[model samples]
Target: MQNTAFTTAWRKGVIARYLTVAGATVDLTGCGDHTYYRCTGCGHGTHGVSVIERVARERAQGHAETCRALPRPTH
Candidate 1:
């Protein structure tokens, strides 16, 4: 399936973000010439940067499917 969940331009270094059903986000960040994804809800994501863009994007999308973590409110 095609992933259209990524939203852009909301934060620096954030290439895209996948907002979960519970309002948590899976963020795709660009690090130098590499890329990595991190989840704000369950805190489950790739441990290190992946040079392959497709792999990283797919991983982020898949994680969003099962993650039901609600967003943490800012103080």
Candidate 2:
């Protein structure tokens, strides 16, 4: 599990990416419970799923919320 601060930051990043036209990629690598997000177009890291989950929990309790879901594949 990730710390509160880290998870919060991760959630913000994911939300931003997901809502943007720039797009972002979310990946679950190996056996890790955490999810990683990367920008496929510019090759930049976005955030992780653990972070998102943390944010979701916080929001359910009346906290504010915040992805960069990467762009589609190119042939």
Candidate 3:
């Protein structure tokens, strides 16, 4: 038997998310007027995007489409 921790964007204040090719998650989170994406697989993410929602979404989708890193263990 094993246990793993599962979380959600809404619960964590994330605005959106995408699933990577390896089943990992790319979370889109925002603070105040700034938005960004962070990958749970290989720690790939965005920075200094100002308040551009489209750019954040675009980068998140692009990374999700190509990222092959498997989801890291939740232990």
The best candidate by TM-score is 3
Which scores better on TM-score, 1 or 3?
Answer: 3
Q: Which stretches of candidate 3 lie over 4 Å from their true place?
A: 1-11, 31-33, 47-51
Give the TM-score comparing model 1 with the true structure, all chains together: 0.73
TM-score of each: 0.73, 0.27, 0.75
RMSD for each of the candidates: 5.4, 13.0, 3.9
- For model 1, give the 10-residue run with minimal summed lDDT: 1-10
Q: Write the per-residue lDDT of candidate 2 for residues 5-66, one digit (tens) a residue.
A: 23323434343223223333332222223434444434444244444544433322221111
Ranking by TM-score: 3, 1, 2
Name the better of 1 and 2 by lDDT.
1
Output the lDDT of residue 38, model 3: 87
Best by lDDT: 3
Alpha-carbon error at 31 in model 2, in Å? 10
- Where does model 1 exceed 4 Å of error? 1-9, 31-33
lDDT of 1 by residue, 1-75 (tens): 332244323567888787776667898887544888888888887767465667777888888887898655544
lDDT per residue for candidate 3 within 1-75, as digits (tens), equals: 221114532437678888887888888888545887888889988754555778888888999899999878764
Better of 1 and 3 by lDDT: 3
